[model samples]
Target: MTLGRTSTVPLADLVRRPELGLVVLAGADRLDRPIRWAHVSELRDPVPYLLGGELLLTAGVNFPEDVDGYVRGLVAAGVQALGFGVTPVYDEVPASLVDACVRQGLPLVALPATTPFLAVSQAVGVALAAAEHAELRWLSEAQAALTRAALRPNPLPTLVTALADLSDWWCALLDDAVVAKAGIEEIDPVVVHMARRLRAVSGRRSGSTEVGSWHVVGYPVAAARVLVVGAARPFSVADRAVIAVALALLALADRSDGRSVTKMLLGDDPHEGYRVVRGQRKARGDAEIDLGTGLVDADGDRMRAIVTTVPDVVAAQTAGWLLAVSSPVGVGDLPSADREAARMLERAVAAGRPVTVDDGVSGLVDPEAAARFAATVLAPLATRPELVETLRIWLACNGNWDRTAAELGVHRNSVRHRIGVVARELGVDLADTQRRMELWFALRWSD
Candidate 1:
């Protein structure tokens, strides 16, 4: 089977090769890092002259009196293991070095006197090149798979599946890492670490996981990163590039880069297209224009177009035309131009319009979604039925004890007591903005 480019043959796999005449003091299964090749040398203090993972070969020209120090130096310098070739100068593996290696947990191979060091080094180098070549072949296959998928009328699903197969792992596409996707139920620690690092480095969401024997790949879609995790022993390089290309294409398609017109009109970056304007009330700060829009003063025009003359834009399956407006307005302003656009789009779809947008879009969405999300903060108190609803009401009233008490038909002191109870149950800091935002998002379900 073709392997992806990101794949590496495990070090253990190399050890399993029967033709190498290689001796194993260390097992072949170690994959903590990659071995570039094997090295053969005659120096006693090879540490100074050597790089790590050399599969070191030495004839012990100046064998150490204090072998512990020598072994420590090798390990410290990143040597994977030691192979001592017995020669006339040192006819047997030194007892001191062997003891030191065993004590330090470094792998030590006893090289046969009849076997030349060159043979061992040559064998390892050949294996490494072959492994790398195999990875390239795997990557070529992945590219072919993508080409086939792209030829399909609807390529999203096919492309995603092809990615999964190439990585040899289960995968999930995310609009935001926070938002979960189908077939990806949990985020493993390794995947999370890689995702965060890649996002920080690339300013794009990406992640990979090595669960048990398999390697997983994750990258962004919309605002989220797609997670592909499998049980293969190692990941190939080609697989990594394939993932990068696949995600890039997804972003190009304007699907997972979080560049929704809603996001843009709300003043988020669209990467390559569209512009967004946040209201003074919302105050997200800064404006964005899509490079593809082909306009100067793009944000300004985009705003004007939406409010003064344009029709609503509809999402594929959802009802209503999508419209965005700026400035302050009360939550009661539902069904305004923006809301109407959503409604109109829904109606148009009901008729025959593929999509529509309206310029008069303005209005606050019902806060109920956010409120319900916030109520999740009280979920832990589910066991305390007497206090659950009361806690929700207190928090809902903006932590106003008097108002909460009035609503709960109880005294202010009782409201305060119940809030304390709720706070204790939720295990959240009432004062931290981040924590509060989580609760708020849950209440509004917007986050």
Candidate 2:
């Protein structure tokens, strides 16, 4: 088997070996093409077995009468050169075959009577093996360099630069948009478009497509994160191995970076106080501003910020984000704030605006207690999702029958009936404002 394109030996190198006793009779200028292997075949039609870049040898034992057709077939099969042995068959290279090879631009090699085809094959084999060994060594060196870079203070930029250097191509780490790039001033629009397309299609770990003269390959590093490479040609097996190493390193760096951010956010540093925000759109600001404001995840869907003063709900609403804000708390209480922010996020999503929590629900005591109370109170309607949803909407509308019906896309009488069933099943009076208040808290906390 032949090593891939990256580790191929040129046909001229093989021809230059004096021990092979091979002479190029045609296509001298085309000797630079890569030679994958030296294949021996005496059959009249050996094109079916060829995989391109082979130096085909023959003794003329089964040489076809149509010399032009034979040469054409070999060219079509991507045979790098034709070696005619002059011992057991025609004693000399035929003029017809030489003319045909010259016409087809296929290099013709004359194997002398004393030189065996096996010698040339062995030389080519040894050369290919050496090339493959060198390629592997290069890949190993590149992997080591990338690993070292990954351990540096800023690993992402280092990894990107190392990958581009190793591959001799531009590389980019696409976190939502272009987060880190190297070997190129600006990312091509086609690469950006392909990155977005790959992100949208889940389970597709890797893909390749053409962009202008460049070949673009993309690998999904994480959810909403992609690694893109642009090169003049397709990547070789060795190139792909290096890319896989870089991807793994990048993933490790991301996990470690996230943990570091989390630790800093939750540390007991006296100046540490932050809020976590989740939204559907990417945050807009300067790079330094973004870094100072918060750590935005690669997906651009979430951020955690260190701020002395919390942002107002009105600012979030005006920006068209379903924002959730947490009350100022100590590092130890940040986890509780996260949960409170999550609940507020849910409420904001439902209300199509922003929600802020100064201190979580006062009447519910705690989430566990509220859950237990909801189980006891709403167990009767547990199996009826429609009734539970109606109850929730009805409570959210403050017992307004007509508004609840409008929201549920049902008649006011249907809302009234579901509410009546809910009250009777739990044996509670719906008209009692105190009971309504308790039910509302239960619904909100349980959800």
Candidate 3:
């Protein structure tokens, strides 16, 4: 209910009420059309001051003959309803005016002979004010309802119900599967948009959006995500605000552990998680590990990183030395928290004791750790300049002598010989996929 930025009274409700005094009333079908209200003054060209929806009042000062041109002019001006004021100059509601209105089906209202035009104007003004008040009240109630729903013990249920109520349509919460939560009997395409946004936002760290006519607010929920979505068929401002509040509440309710990488790297027990390297064993660990510094190719550049995790002797031996990477803390200027974390891991390994690389972020000690260990162990073999390229090509081809030979333009026998030299130097069986994998990483680490 809005009128000229003032309060809005529904035209339907305003018309039905009797105290407003309707000497003649326009039917809703005509009034409901696209209408913008304006007060006009020019008797010669009423259409000029009219922006349509005008209850044009006149004392028949310049009543046109035949009425055809005058009525057509009003229609062309996009007038939704007409109000004629009767005075001594025009003592009666003219038969011509009524005939024209009936012919066109353009609603016609007669301002009473006793009633001044001022009274009609005042009534419309009052209706506008009422409409505005109703709009404000609707917004307030909607916000309160959404707020209450957000705090409920089972928030999703409350949210779905709220959305249905707001939109006056059925709603559903869908993950991989659709859960019919509340509102109408079946799912609508509009609600489907809401579900998709909710799922998409679950994986991202931040951000929100408005989709179609509806305002969809998504938040991370425990083991799931949630969205409160709705608006009247096309959605409105009030509905958007309500959904936004619901999303905020859901976010607050369910928080997550930011230490996913740490938990995974630590293995079982944090106390004795890291493996120790001694002489030959240290050489083997080094062969499998890669510190990632300066290993670049035509395709992509490699960034150096250190992964330090809680010590687990068995897990480290099995998984190789852990190195932390892929953190939110980007590799920037040295002496940052991330740089410090890398330093901690390096120091722990250098000290030959299980140590924790805690820089207030998570750690990763997995296949990446094994890659680092392999590189360290194979450093001596890689130093032989002649053998370096040969071993690299062979491993890259997965020890396939023929493919390695073709890539390197060497004979199969020569390729086999170079591979043997690498295997013997690294003290591993090149024929074993597992052993080949270890040597492969060692070569990468050395690079």
Q: Which candidate's TM-score is highest? A: 2
Model 1 accuracy (lDDT, Cα): 0.54
286 Cα displacement, candidate 1 (Å): 50
Instruction: Assess each prediction's global lDDT (C-alpha) against the native.
Output: 0.54, 0.77, 0.53
Which candidate model has the greater lDDT, 1 or 2? 2
TM-score (all chains, Cα) for each model? 0.46, 0.55, 0.42
- Candidate 2: tens digits of C-alpha lDDT, residues 112-188: 98888889889888998899897877877888888767755568887999888875689999967777899888887
* Stronger candidate by lDDT (2 vs 3): 2
Rank ordering of all candidates by TM-score, starting from the highest: 2, 1, 3
Model 2 residue 423 lDDT score: 89
Tens-digit lDDT track of model 1 for 1-447: 235533223455445556544465543334334555677666667778876665677888877777898888888988777777777678778878777887887777776777777777776667667877877676677677765554332345556666666654666554335332334457666766666665555454545556766566665554444444454555544556777676666555445223433443443432322212211111233222222221112232123223211222333113322233333223233225344434433333233332232322212333344346445665686578767667557557777878888887889998778767767878877666677556644533322
Candidate no. 1 TM-score: 0.46
Better of 1 and 2 by TM-score: 2
Off by over 4 Å in 3: 1-7, 12-20, 25-38, 42-45, 52-56, 64-78, 103-105, 166-181, 189-236, 243-447
